[model samples]
Target: MKPNVLLIMVDQMRADCLSILDHPVVDTPNLDQLARDGVLFENAYSATPSCVPARASVLTGMSQASTGRVGYQDKVPWNYEHTLAGEFTNADYHTQAIGKMHVYPTRNLTGFHNVVLHDGYMHYSRFKHNTKTIESQEYTDDYLNWLRGKTGQADLIDLGLDCNSSTVTRPWHLAEELHPTNWVTTESIDFLRRRDPTKPFFLNMSYVRPHPPFDPPQVFYDMYKDLELPDPSFGGWAETEDTSGEGMSPVTAKGLVPKMRLKRAQAAYYALITHIDHQIGRFLNAMQEFGVYHNTVILFASDHGELLGDHNLFRKSLPYEGSAKVPFILADPGNNLGLKENSRVDKAVEMRDIMPTLLDAADIGIPDTVDGKSVMPLCKDGEDMPWREYIHGEHAFGEKSFHYITDGKEKYIWFSQNGEEQFFDLENDPQEMTNLLKVVDYQERIEKRRNQLVKELEGREEGYSDGKSLIAGRTPKPTLRFVFE
Candidate 1:
């Protein structure tokens, strides 16, 4: 029988938050145990570093360039022919997505047999003008409808917190069992109980938390309310000024927040992560009770990382480690594929790799459209297997638009709006506190990485490169024309 696959995904969680990774403040005992049972990938990234495009890569098993979703534009149709769930469905698996599809039309199944979606306060979908259409959460979000049925509330944001704001935070107002995080687990457990027992399953249990509004359940919030949390890392290259009042805005993307306010946000953010972690534990226990825990292939990851005041940045879409890196843990508890247990791999992987990896675990054939390689070999003793030299990441963030190349030990970033550049020796400067572009010892290394970026962009329609040098001042678009074609 084919092994069941469980892909547990979270939103806006930092790469370093796992307690196993020595995160001083946050504790994720369940995830730490999950890592011990399988493999922990230390250098995983979201190439696009935003929700829409990053999730596109996860679902389609394609790079950002191939998906033509290099930024955070919503409402574009997910026109891909092959998806992770579609492939599993082709193999006769009972595929279900329980939470947070984040796709356009909101309910577009994207190949899942069914989707229980709650995209978590999408501004475009929740716009008063769009509420009459399918774009509204009222029409598409199962969790929202369910919440209303349970609490007589019209919306999840009844507490008046902006979904995207990092500065505002409070404990969850509803009953703990009614929270979105718990609802995702509760629904997932219910699926396991009622699912087709004759066929293997492919379940994507996604959560939207640790993202914003900074609200975890009240118990979780109090757990870290007074604990000393690590201060956000500040790079010398980051602007420290509060000019233009952007610093005081609740949803400011890049600005200096008052230290106390930032700390409260961090506390709430960590609380959400731990809450999700416990919910994951709850789901795993249910899997064990159902007698499928040992036979399952589990993969856990996040769409992207939140900056959370790192370098004075509050949200994602930047190429910094705090914004792009994500936690990736894959556990094959049954040893079905001969994977090494409790291992850590330093290979630089990304969201696109996930689909292929899970497919490989289930002995399914990968589709031709996939650009990512299966990490199964790396999980075993196949060190001799050829691997990617680096990962190329980019985002279209207007004035802050950037393309980056990193091999985990070093990173090179180039701003498209201007000819500005930043380089970091990631091994020595893990916090990215100093830019090393002008360092005499690293000029040659920086040049080689720059050429790699040029090669990657050679034939793109954006005219970002000339096959020899990167060109500046080109307008960066959220998607390429091919997506429409």
Candidate 2:
């Protein structure tokens, strides 16, 4: 029988939060053990760092450009013919997804054998006047329906927390078992029990937490409330005197917040992560009890990272490491693929690589539709294996819309609305405290990176480049025109 595959994913989890990676405050013993037993990729990034577009790349094995989802947008139909789950089903694997499949037309399934979904709080789906009746959570989300059935409450908002708020912090108001994170683990373990024994299974266990609401169960919240957490890092370029009172808003993307509130939010966010870690431990133990522990191929990653007040920015979709980078671990505990154990790779990989990697591990054929190459070679052959030099990332954030290219050691940024440029030597300053754009010594290197960006955007509908240089003032769209084609 082919090896079973398990893809563990979390929403808005920072790449640097693992204790193995020396994250100062957060304790994730389960994740740390997962890393120890797997090959960890230190430079994995989301090419388009947001919930919707990032998930598109993960599901389809397509680059952001190929997916035509270069930015965050909701309500767009997921019209792809191939998906990670669909491909597994094609090979006769029993594929089931539990928790957070943020696709549109919420029940689309995207080719899963079955999906137990909880996309968390989406404004578009919850609106009273939503034109598409099928889009509402009441009509689709399995977790919400379960919560409503278990408790009399209609929604998570009963706790008085906004899903996307950055400044708000609170403990979950319900029983610990009812939290969405625990529900995902519980449903996943249940699937293991109920799965078909004759066929290899593909299980996607996705958790929606550490994203916002900043609410963890009370025990988790107490874990880091008074631990003297690290303050948020601010870049010199991002500091401002305006203090326009915008930061006071609960969900403002860019603004200075009170130090106490920010620390509390960080504590809550860490609490949620630790809570997820514990839940992951629970599921892993269940896997052992069910006798699938030895013959499984497990890959762990996140859709994207939260800025968590880095550079005074909250949420995702920015080119900064805190928002775009994510933790990636591929563990073949059975040595099914002869992979190097307890290793680390610094290659610049992205979410798009996931489908091909998992498919390759299962000895399944990678379809021609996949833009991402299987990263299995990197694990087997180490740095001697050939790989892409850098990854290009972009997001459509109005005036803040930007394009970036990085090779893990350095990054180059170009604003599409204006011709402004910024560069950071990530090797020397991982926090991106200083911009090196105007530095006399780094001018030649900066020019080379700029030319690379110009080459990357050479031919496109957006008219962002004219071959020789980047064109300014071009409007960026969340979805490229080819999406409709």
Candidate 3:
């Protein structure tokens, strides 16, 4: 029998936040069970932390900059030809996507042949609002008009935070009962129940909550309300002595995150992650009840990590481990046959490896255009292809941006547009408390990684630099500069 694929994606999830990862504060019994029953990577990093770029990387198996997508709120270029969606479709697999595709303008590939998307929840395109009476149409309207009946607020949504965050609110969380993962899972199970059954299917169950606004149900929030969140592990968000170019309020003095609210925010963030786990558990259980668990290959991961006060940052893309790393788990029950269960792999992996791995798992020929190497062997056994020597990720904002190449022990980052370089030794300073680019002892290592980074990105359009710019890459192409502006 052909294998089925279930790709479960959550937004803003961290690599170390899992119970299997031994995170003390967050509760993830289901995920822990998954880790025990499958293959979990202790170190996995995203190509980019922002929504669109990371999603694009996962879908296309290429760097975001190479895709020419540098910011959120951008669309796939008209010329991106090798997306995994098309490949799966070509493989004769019935492809479908539910929840936050996060791709832009709805016309976005839908990737799958079938799609039921959350227009408002993920990339709700309504223009920002002011006074008058405030407005929201995407999420709630989709829920009321198309999704739920007029009275469809029946279940899901209704987290402790104001329901105003939902589809109807200015920013819109919808109702706590309409919580994203729960809604996403519900749609996925419904699809599975109604599937044709004559063919294998590939489904993308994506969630955008637990990304921000940290809104969880009253009960979930209660679970972590009193738990004291660890303080910022890396001193704080310090700025260069000259703050003229980037002068902003220190993290502690932000809009609503003053002293009194930080505690609640932290708790809410943890609760939201637990909320994602709960819904994922429900979905996994449903697969078992339907008896498809053993036949399906389940891949669970997140677009990127969030900063619940880590390094005084909020969302993603800072080169900090907190926002750069994500959780990854792959389970193929029957194929495991006699393979060990409840095991883990400690090798370093990059999110870019996902596309190749998934297609390889499905027995689809990975197109030569894909820049990632398959890590499937690592799953079958811890030893694979000597593991990767280094992985690359980038975040580009206009002409200026940052790129990183890490050997797992040390990381070298270059802020290209500004010509600034940074080096951090994770093996020694886990929190990345200090920049060692100029440290006499680490200078050689820094130069080596820097050269490696340039070499890796060489002959690649977006990766071009003084040494490699003249060589042909993807294209000199137009910039989606409007999004960054």
Residue runs of model 3 more than 4 Å from their true location after superposition: 76-79, 119-124, 128-176, 240-257, 335-340, 398-400, 457-464, 468-485
The sequence of per-residue lDDT tens digits that candidate 1 reaches over residues 1-485 is 78999999999999999999999989999999889899999999999999999999999999999999999898798989999999999999999999888887778899999888878998887787746675777888899999889878557778788989987788998889998999999999999988999999999999998888788899999989899989889989988787687878888887877778888888999999999999999999999999999999999999999999888888899999999999999997777778788999998999999999999999999999999989999999645677899999999999999999998889999999997999999999998999999999999999999999999999899899999999999989998999988
Candidate 1 accuracy as TM-score:
0.99
Alpha-carbon runs more than 4 Å astray in model 1: none
lDDT by residue for model 3 over 274-357, one digit each (tens)? 888898888888988988888887788888886655654455666778878889887776664333466777677766678898
Q: Which stretches of candidate 2 lie over 4 Å from their true place?
A: none
CA shift at 47, candidate 1, in angstroms? 0.5
* Clashing residue pairs, backbone N/CA/C < 3 A, model 2: none
Q: State the lDDT of candidate 2 residue by residue for 1-485, as single tens digits.
A: 99999999999999999989999989999988887787999999998999999999999999888999998888889999899999999999999999998888777889899999999998887787854676777888889999999997658788788888877898998899999999999999999989999999999999998888887999999989999898788889986753587778888787878888888899999999999999999999999999998899999999999998998889888999999899999987777688888999999899999999999999999989999978899998989988998899999999999999998889999999988889999999999999999899999989989999999899978999999999999989999998887
Compared with the true structure, the alpha-carbon lDDT of candidate 2 equals: 0.91
Q: Each prediction's TM-score against the native?
A: 0.99, 0.98, 0.83
Which ten residues in a row are the worst by lDDT in model 1? 128-137
